[model samples]
Target chain A: MGGKFSIERVNEYLWEIPAEGDMRVPARIYADRNSIDFLLEESRNKEWNALAQIRNVARLKGIQMAALAMADIHPGYGFPIGGVGAFDLEEGIVTLAGVGFDINCGVRSMVVSIPKGDIEKRKEELARELFESIPAGLGSTGSLRLNFDEIDRVLTEGALFSLKRGYGTAEDLEYIEEGGRIAGANPSNVSLHAKKRQLKQVGTLGSGNHYLEVQYVDEVFYEEAARVFGLSEGSVVISIHTGSRALGHQIGTDYQKVLRKASQRYDIPVYERELVGAPIKSQEGKDYISAVRAGINCGFANRQVIAGLVRKVFARVFSTGENDIRTVYEVGHNNLKVEKHTIDGVEKELLVHRKGATRAFGPGRREVPEKYRDVGHPVLVGGTMGTFSYILTGTAKGMKDTFGSAVHGAGRVKSRKQARKGLSGEKVIEELARKGITVMAHSNKGVSEEAPDAYKDVEQVVNIMEGAGINRRVVRLRPVICIKG
Target chain B: MNRNGHETLEHTADMGVRGWGENIETAFKEAALAMIGLMAELDRLRIKRRIKLECSEPELEDLLVEFLNRLLSQIDLEELVCVDINVITIERLGGNYCLKATAGCIKREEVKERLLVEVKAATYYGARVVLLESGIWEAVCVVDI
Candidate 1:
């Protein structure tokens, strides 16, 4: 199978997989030489291969250009994690695999006025406060329990619903993607079972790689960009990484059945059963798009509520005004968005599906918030529990190349079980504490699974994006307090 | 190695459950139990309630996914963790494969503190249900977290 696929180096930072067999378009990968070598090595084995999954995406109907994979590309259920693709509105199809099961799973960063030195002194207390305030781990329930009507409003209104309920201020909405509300969300497209699952799960950080971290800007790469994005060396910030929870999961489960049937009815050939999709104009496709948008809203609202909770903790812990803590940006990695992009010298509407990838719209794009319109949207890239996360800005070159997208985080290098074998949660906690970082988790098993060595070097991942000119580095954030599920 | 049992398999980001038994029905039951164990400590959960599930699909693979997803839905709706599964019947009906099973669930409160990981949905990736030449039945699949 590896021999069947030939990859040609287009440049130092790009590789191309030419169209072959049933593939309608070629596939391009953005990675440095080392990352490409790692991928090639992985391709040698017959197990779930990322390159093959990328090609399978190319075979999907009405794929506008080529399938794209970021430097963090890894084998996922259907679409490779860190994969991106766009489909023609009139001819392309939508698949549940593209958006992923955890719909709109994303990262949001908030800047605080406190300095790094002050946070370092209170890291332990802050970690404890955040861990207790934020419900985490498997089946963790939050304070909010919505009924049928309230759930419908959450599906439709998104973060605005949370705002109306006094979770956060109106200003927070401006920094959120889609103003914290994805339009065309139809609660009717969501099932009652899905709603029931989300009734008590909102604002909770579900397990497995989801976390809340208190960090400080350790290094400023592009000083001007950092200034414009409200960052300074040694300033403290908080990052929340989570998604739509059970609601999004149920939506994916419900739609997989519909799209599988749609594939059969429309006579669409599925290379992998998980890659099944229906034509974008077909009834199944429309319904899925609506339901996914509703799921996206659920994510926005969840993060918004969590952000409010974080602010409350910060105010109590640091004795700072809540108004001083402000959101820098909120962006979803697993999602599908209908956007206008220039293709072949023509601007066309395409449904862009980014799985384990983040949207990095360049400056002047209307989608970017007005305050930072001249500096481009901030791309929040979260690292593993003990590693350094980065903030990068979208580039015009990225808009021209990979549909204004960048790698979401440091891709995993090992399986959780393998990570747990060599690492102990208590040992990891002690090591971080020795380095002046506070760590808290509900389960030692969760901590062992999220060991820092399990992930690739995030600095290297970000450097590739910068080298490729897809995204510009802003600042690097090192964790002071980390909380895991 | 056991005649009917399940084991947790390693996946890079998520997790996998692989089960084996003497027949397909038992293999499916083992897979369901594996999924339950991954979510929480199944030993601590008591069978407080029982729910019957019936599903039919044209493909055996789809039937397996449906079976697991139905169990997941029951967990979310009832706010409970499944502890046991009893396959009453599994047979080919016309062109479709049909399954009827009873799932016993315990209230979430009983095992909330013991929960380890939350599985969102069972995916079709690398899914397989096969009868080996050794006359043993096997089923394997990955679940999203």
Candidate 2:
């Protein structure tokens, strides 16, 4: 990573590493001058070199346009987190690193129509209720204990399964990405072990950075777009951050071995050990994709169930109707999808891999909800337990360049070890409380490990994307209460 | 970080676990302990249940990952918090290396108040299994959290 490279400054907010030996396409990154310096420093220090990972992704077969990384780029296993790689559907490859272990790990935000002051008055009780009602932490299990067959239904029906069980309202589906269900998901492709892992984990939030936060709109950058998305300054909102639990983990484990073998069988170059994949047409590839889709569904169903629980808690605590909270939006960060994007003005379907990144379909896309069609859907950006999160919307320019992708969050600056050095859970809670944020966490070590100091500045990360004209800010949210697993 | 036994290494986003001993079996067992340490406060887990585990891979590096993933699956299935491992054998079976072991695991409820983080999987990235010139066999890998 430190030796040599063919990188050129394309603009103030963009850089391009042209295709060299074995690289099929150029690698593009959206970052300001300072962020670029930080990324290079990571390589120079031999920390996680996201720039090198992006370069390796450019080596993938049939990769469309250019391998890309958002401003929040950080080192991941093979593909850099906040990495985006799209490839021709017919000639592409499906890889484990592209999607990561927590398939469809995402954020779901709901607008809570209540006075922020009233909620703050009882913040301690609300935080405790949420932490208790929602099962969280390592190996936490939920109330819904489904058998194998029902797990399959959960995979195929997605949020519908949760809705049928009276976990959520029917109207909720309309606001979710893909209507909360992915059609190509075939449950048969999912392993029995994976289903077993999910039997009691459907609605549970797993540990390590996953959280349920109560926040309020702190500022609005674009008034018109904010109105369309139901955001008003000082309005309350709740965001759930989690994904398919052990089911997704098991699926990733099972598929990585299969795809690793497939890579050897198909003579696909193994750029990295975890970067192994198979041709899209291969049986192994098709099965892995189907399983991944099922994993995506598991993520939607999980959030739906958790959202229902959150709504019930709010209704009970504030003495208001559950319907008072409306779905703002739901989107996955780590995922794989087939979407049509124009390259050189030739619109065609391509397999898009967004790992630690989220889809930000621009205005006028049929996939976006009708009401927000003119202004594009909201891209929820989660900040740390003590920082400001933002709601961003895609732009036509974003679609043209990044295939409408945006950074997931403030990328990590320190390791878990470094973050928790001499830090304790009680100390973290005290720090957050000093900032007027309430935290309820199951693990003190986890609280310390995910301390705000571990992450890069989210506001700076979001501004880079806004400066790049790829994603525009709508509203900023400040955390009031956080329930961490 | 102790190289003679088991210790956790630091990675940017995940846990880097390593274990070593005079032989491969002990190294594999110590490695499992290092991974378990990342999930739970080991000394707090009291109740124990015995179970058998086995895994096979083409190379020792991969065998280490397979062995760790199998432990993860057991944790999900049995709500386990493993305290000790008895690696009965690490034999070369046919063209592949196979590891078989018996583990004493406590239910997660036993350490309900002391759990740390959920490990997603053991990854092949940055994984290694080496028999050092000092005659100590060491197994190392990064576990996705």
Best model per DockQ: 2
Q: Write the residue-wise lDDT of candidate 1 on A1-485 in tens digits.
A: 45577899998888999998878999999888998888888878747778888989998999988999998888887899999999999999998889989999999899999877778777778888899999888778888989989999999899999888778778889999899999999999999989999999889998889999999998999888898888999888899999999999999999999998899999988888789889999999999999999999999999989988898888898888868888899999999999999987899999999999999998999999998899898999999898999999989889988889999999988887788897698998999888877888887777888889999899888888898899998999999888888
How high is the CA lDDT of each candidate model? Answer: 0.89, 0.91
Residue A266, candidate 2: Cα error in Å is 0.7
lDDT per residue (tens digit) for residues B7-74 in model 2: 88777777789899989999999999899888888774564688899889999988999999998898
Off by over 4 Å in 2: A1-3, B1-3
Real interface contacts reproduced by model 2, as a fraction: 0.79
CAPRI-wise, candidate 2 is high
Report the TM-score measured on chain A for model 2. 0.99
